[model samples]
Target: MPQHRNISCHLYIGDTKAMEYNVHNVDNRSTAHIVSEEGQTFSFKIEAGTALMSAARLDLELWADGYKLDCFTFTESVYEVDDAQVRDQVTGAIKIVKLRFAKLNTVDQGPSNADDAEAEQLKRLGTLEIKLWRSESNVSQSTTFPYADCPLQTPIHEKKIKGQSVSHVTSLESKGTVAQQSSWGYITTKIDPYDRPWVAFVFKHASKALLQSEGIVPKDEVKEKGAAVASAKGKKAQSSRAKVNDTKNEESKVEDVKFDDDVAAMSQPQLRQEIMRLRKRPGDSLDQSVVKARRTMKCVRTPDADNLLSTAEKGDKRK
Candidate 1:
């Protein structure tokens, strides 16, 4: 029978104490559930300008049987290395780093004793040390931990064999691709002595409104503040609009008086020029003035109906 061991992972940020969690070897069938959980997972928000020196440095360590096995560090100039600039919402700048582990068998030298062989079997898995690096070559970019180039190859038994009674040998390993490994390497962080998977941490900025929207901030406080802001904005907008309307009314009255005086004092050419100038001024109405000016220029006038009737009656009596 194959021997199994429990592995635990711990995370450290800067000089802060390490946060430990158990590591899990997730089955392929349970990957969908893991992905769903990660998708629905929300993070705690840190307010803007909140100085947290620990967030700048990150370290991850893996241990087995209370012995430290692997250590991954990102403590050197973290802010300068990555573009984790959190401007507004907590979801603005998200960094996800996955650490993959591999098993290495102990090579047999000269003559291996029974005790040595047992010890090697117990410590079969090898340690992995990682240092983070940034990639800025592509338009669609991300912070990547390159562990795919070095993979520990191993083989497992395949259940289905083509028309054969015996099981066939097949490989059981990940190539560190999104399709091959959709999770941020699993860890068993439970207290019930069972293996469970846990997703990694996310770092981002959080404002009052953003926190309230994500249910991190109190809803009542956000609502009251939002209402106050809206009320103040509405009053300011109304006052500005009223001032604009009054200015427009006064300007319109002044324009009408000016136009009437210009037509009475100026020649036909000057009146036409004034009309053209008024037409060029946007939002100025000169329909009545233009029509009256055109009629006077043409010397066209309608006689009074009373005078015309009196003249027609006198002509009829004479006839």
Candidate 2:
């Protein structure tokens, strides 16, 4: 949360408030979710200082990454903070959406249509921001949003996003009636100088790894979190290994043995040998049965496979 002038704002994820790191006097960056106007994945709260009027009329503007969202204005004197549902003034649409990380591509592999956008647009790919202006209630009327649809994090060239540290961008959690309803339309306000907001909160969000890489997060905390994650992943990997081992140790059942044309004259021991012979191969008995990505197999040449097959065939033929 960041507070400037007389207003305080916070970005909340789940039931916990985000961790804030101060940048300057009032400007701070926080670790938070793709913020929401709709109260599902995350919620945002605004608290107005008592220094303001009884019913303070202010235009609330939201921006994620670098794109401006549908802005809104409300006349509410805060008792603690304004946590109530904010909706589209005319359409009564609840602008609930999800923020997602934009997929990135290499320099040459970038989107072909990206040229259509101004370089300025791609500049704000990793910031979550809010601006508030002191406004007159009746003077401010509802207006259309800059974008036609729900604003999402636009993927850009990897080289272009170099300094941003952000790996994720705001994306819709769900594409549904909310985007259609708001059109990102906001309440246009009458301000003396629209360029200067009464208060602005800018948050630059990035992955924990990126934050640690930038030294934004303390190394000790990073190690603690990393250890926790590694522990969980280790348990999962161990379970997977156990399953693979079980499959490998499983006995070759009688039904699994191949049908032989040598009639039923072959001894039971010879039949067992046939199953054993079929289990090995030239590549150290390949175990590459699962997905390639999981890759739980070894590749090596084993002479024992040839020896076992030869011995089994000879015994079967002698019978």
Candidate 3:
């Protein structure tokens, strides 16, 4: 029989306490001895049935002074790191180890509601490969990651291996590129050109409507005030033109009639009669008078018969 040496180690349990244990040498095997400060001792033997410890039993307690610790039994197994022959078995063993550590760490600290924390730690440690498999197609994909680079925020960049379609690689790569391009890199604001014009218009209209709704002043009143200003300008222009015409008449030594008020008061029929009389006067060009009269006319309603005759003549000329 080969002699085995006990391996002793100390570990911290929770935040304020520590645990101590000793492994005793046996017949090509080892036994763990755990001692508590309250004069308590527990013993368990590990048999060397296989190269790796398939099953283990442990007695755990706190070693801190003045604190009463609860006793618990934990069953575990050890596995070789590079045992490809029993990869599934090792994977299951590693999962057990992870669960045990999580339970032990949270025993005194209440519930470890940090799902992301454990996942991130596992990712950083980089000891295991997690996979997603499709049952119908019998295809599988696996990803191995480093513990520190695990996604603490959204999963942006992580290595992935796929067992099936080539299209999946292209899709994932394209998605990753788009994600990287759109990531928030010290930029807090973005302006969209398509939305700017409409947004500005909406803001201006909203402000104007709010002012009117609050009884500040109605838009109708502003429009009426603008029309009054335009009317004043038109009256000033007409008066200036009449003064120039009056000066011209005075320089020619002609007795000019006071026709400004008469023209202003004349209705449509009387204006047409005056235009005919002016056209019939001596030295007046009838063609020029007719053009001027046509230019000054308002709302001329031509006979439908005349319109039809004009259209018929135009069609005849075209034919």
Better of 1 and 2 by lDDT: 2
* Tens-place lDDT digits, model 3, residues 1-319: 1113222222222232222123344332222222122211122222223211322332222111111112222332321111111011222211101100110010223343436544454232211111111112122232441111111122222222111111100000011111122111111112222222101100001123433454543557778899999999999999999999999979654322344345446665566566656566798786775554443442233233234334433544575
Q: Which candidate achieves the best lDDT against the true structure?
A: 2
Provide TM-scores for the models.
0.20, 0.52, 0.14
Give the poorly placed runs of model 3, Cα more than 4 Å off.
Answer: 1-207, 210-229, 249-319
Candidate 1 lDDT by residue in tens digits, 60-177: 3333211222333333332211111111123222223232222222343343333654344233222211122221222222234223222223231221111222111111222232
Ranking by lDDT: 2, 1, 3
lDDT of 2 at 108: 46
User: Residue 287 CA error for candidate 3 (Å)?
Assistant: 18
lDDT of each: 0.32, 0.53, 0.29
Give lDDT for model 2.
Answer: 0.53
Q: How does candidate 2 fare on TM-score? A: 0.52
Q: Encode model 2's per-residue lDDT on 1-319: one tens digit a residue.
A: 5666777777766566876664444332223323222223444677777525733477776776566664667666542221222343456566554544443333546454444364566667667677777776555234554432454334456655555555655555543344454333445445535787777777766565667666775567677999999999999999999998877666333322323233144444554454444444345432331121011111112324345445654665676
